[model samples]
Target: MKHVLLATTGESPQVVTETLFALHQEHQPWPDALYLITTSRGQSKAREGLLERGHLARLCDELGVKQPLFDNSHILVVPDANGVPVDDARSLEDHEALANFIMTQVRNLTADPQQSVHASLAGGRKTMTFYLGYAMSLLGRQQDRLSHVLVSKGYESLADFWYPSQQQGQLHDRQGAPLLTAEGKPLIASAATVTLAPIPFVRHRQSLPAILPQTGESVHFRDVVRLINLGEQPEALRLQIDLAQQLITVSDEESDQRFEFKPSLIGLAFYAMMARATCAEESDLTRPSKKRADTALLKVFLDELMPLCGLQSCADWQTGLKQLLDWSELKGQVKDNTIDALNGGIPDYWFDQRKSELRKLFEQKLPLTVSRWLSPEIIWAEDGALLEQPGSTKGGGYGIPLARKNIEIINC
Candidate 1:
């Protein structure tokens, strides 16, 4: 029984939407067993607040995910209340329970005479995804497999990702025709008339920008790492895009004190990894003891960027950056200092200059050109309003549909 493990955790409604979207898109064999582990609160505000509303419940219903019975089959439920907190003293105990849950589920799935297992770790918190993945490594049979869908680019529209159906909409004016130009001469032009079909369950509106975008919110940097691992999903892309947008919104909010600083999503992600890697807590978290130096942060940062930067293809530049970052991490070197500690060693301008240069290089190398890849034409119904039928649950129902209505467009 090739069991595809489609799981989701966190507050982003998009996570579940993307998971279901992927499952349907591939038309892959259905899971023999399924598991979902929800969390109650987290080390970060967004994570903690995710469980606050009826968000999880609504997501499950919208996606048609069955509640888990474990039934020696598959199961789904919240960890502690919704999910176990990483910072909670009970993390070890919670981790054990998670391991057991996975073990039990896998054992049941593979018990049949004609069964094989294949699990896909699509979405969840970092600890949750990591712990679950680690557990799968242990319990997986020789035939059992594990995989994760990574985002090669960012969020994209569903239309671009999926082929559209002509039955869903109609094009009125289809033409390659000659028209009178400014000189009253005929010129070739193209045009089309189209009609849109209904879209359901999508939140079409954009929210107002927050105050103090650059000040940075209480973001769970760890969560960002985990979500990014599930690359290219519309949900994952939106979460990252939303973060970048929020930062801009915050800057808008604190306009009086705002400075012109646009933090690149890739840069911020790399910075977060460095902050966590060099933290004394991480040294303790790992098994084998390794030396912790100020420069260690720079090394960690470079290692993370190497893959994303496609450095292996550019060996000369890769070697140069690696050596420079290595030197920057050395004792008494000021380059490795967190954003707060620049003044005592290298001039503050140098740090900013390096970051600017790095950002430019990345832009040149891997430009944010999702637009160039594919453009999803989301056709909204005649009503500019989004919430379909506020209180109704009929066929046309009430809410906007996730797959097509609030169509997400990601550049490849």
Candidate 2:
């Protein structure tokens, strides 16, 4: 597996080498790659200290360890919209740009399942540190880790101290005097102690909303934060598939009001799965297959509707629920009415059409956040949106991720 060390650095680029030494002392594998995020002046400082001065190489050579991949590209400098690097983060725009840049990189890195990050939160601006740490908490998995390098007091402020060396080396104090130990011996680089402090962080991926935009799109840090803080969904809303009334009803417990609106037959049929799964806590929700209609496929949809329809008394019904109640003949009649439209016993176009129709209807009628959650487009894997089994097209089939206590399927 590829192990990467991601760190934010400022003028104190020694944080990288110190972090490396700390990891080495803890018996951690040398990272396969190393990345430093910083601003223009910080970039110059890192280039001079670690690259030009050969401090990074010297540390590795003195420690007898191979160096992780490091070069100019590894030092990522935050830049402006015009691609020009800035000296420091003095403006709000610079910090915003810095956040997006850092989070974007972290997102791309953690998206790879084979990679594990050892994020060193030991450097960079206070905002940069916060952004990187937050990014790790949001996107990091179990295998990934977060750490900070803690240098003992004597070495913490020493500009020349990167890591302890095997051989003794001369060093000056802040006063430009020959630094000496308690015994008046010359201060040595090898005498300093660096410790890697592990930071406990919560992984919030499990708590993200089910309606996140489809995967693979670039997600901004602020947008993600906004979604996470979108607050709680209105819980006690009953979604009634009133077959008798030929309309759907949303009951808001807090307001004690009922919202009634009729959807097309196809829309009603598709929503039955979403409403049932959300209210019943069904674990096997899935999207229809793109193939010819079959009894088995039709059964999947019927299974949800049958219980709500109470088919035995459908003789008194005035809606199409009666024909839909007869599961055996339902597939043939549906395929015959909509010839060449069956895909997994469902019309091929109905999936997209019904979702769009439902969205518009609920948006126009209900005018609440519940409308969106009830008919979300994307079925997130960890969002409890669907079962990723042999027949489930995970995202192809949608499920409502609302709490069962918040949802009740009233069959009218």
Candidate 3:
């Protein structure tokens, strides 16, 4: 298995060299690959000190260690709320963005089973380290490792000190003052000692259900924590899909709290269909296929979908679904159920698209915890492979964990 070294750094880019120094010279040596996470200013320090000045290369060359695959691409600059790299993480929005970025990075690396990640919590702000640590707890596998590098006390935070080099006789502090020994001899880089401290962290992935983390490019910190901490939600809240107003409403009887917001048309359909099925206490709905058309599936879809049409506020979606299904109009209303299948069926891409987009919508609009509670948990195939079965419980279709009594579909 390829060992990957991932580190979070701040103004002190030396952490990278320190970590490599403490690990690479002897035991476990340099990783097969290396990655760094830092802010805009931090990236500048890393670029200048580690790359431009050739410090990283020099350290490896002198230590007789093979360099790992790394460059500017491996240096991930933490983006701000606007998706722009920020000099520092300070604002509330910046912190949230940082957390999401860190989570995304961690999840992406861990998603690959072939690679074992060695995460270095040796740099960056406390919040950055905390987020990285928590992400490891949530997604880290047995092969994964977490650590923080400890530098000799006097050598810590010294800008000029990347790693101790016996070639240099004197080192300067951040203020540019020469560091010297008690005998008045100039301090050499060899005076610094760096050690790796392995931190034992609880791996929650083994204990929790696989679906809780929401596999994809991004996951919000609040949602994951809430999902893990607040597992098996209480049944006091009811959900509503207001077709007329194009809104999904959540009301709590015990707390007397109500939340209302509009969702994407496709997401609306997928969710509303499931909500309708639950209310009727019907069987699980099968996923739409991308390849061949199944009349039974189309009919079942229209049966729940047609009732949602005929509203002025929902016209935009009406037109979209019309085009999607290649339908000029239904043969009759949802009650008649005689809509003929002019074409084979709608593309299954719509189904997958809805799954991803709908989850994002819920994550963006609903309460952090409530969003996960309302998401459609799909048992997606490994690749583009379509699941052949129909029932949600068996892993081939869509499943909503909510009970029948909790869903209320309001027609236009």
> Model 3 over residues 1-412: C-alpha lDDT tens digits?
8889999999888998888988864486358888999988888888888889988888888888778888899999988888999888778998889898898898888877888999999999898899999889888999999999998867788877888776665898768899876677776788878888999999876554444345575776765554444434637667888877778886666554565667655457667876765566444455655466554545555544555564222234334345434433443322222222324454455556666776666555343455555676542233323333222333344545565577777876
Candidate ranking under lDDT, highest first, comes to 3, 2, 1
TM-score of 1: 0.27
lDDT of 3 at 368: 41
Give per-model TM-scores: 0.27, 0.62, 0.59
Better of 1 and 2 by lDDT: 2
Question: What shift in Å separates residue 268 of candidate 1 from its native position after superposition?
Answer: 64
The parts of candidate 2 lying over 4 Å away from their true place are: 80-83, 173-176, 181-185, 209-218, 233-268, 272-412
Q: Which segments of model 1 are wrong by more than 4 Å?
A: 1-8, 41-75, 78-91, 151-412
Report the C-alpha lDDT of model 2 over 369-393, residue by residue, as the tens digit.
4565556454434455454331234
Model 2: worst 10 consecutive residues (lDDT sum): 313-322
Cα miss at 375, model 3 (Å)?
15
Please give the TM-score that candidate 2 achieves against the real structure: 0.62
Better of 2 and 3 by TM-score: 2
State the local distance difference test value for candidate 1.
Answer: 0.34
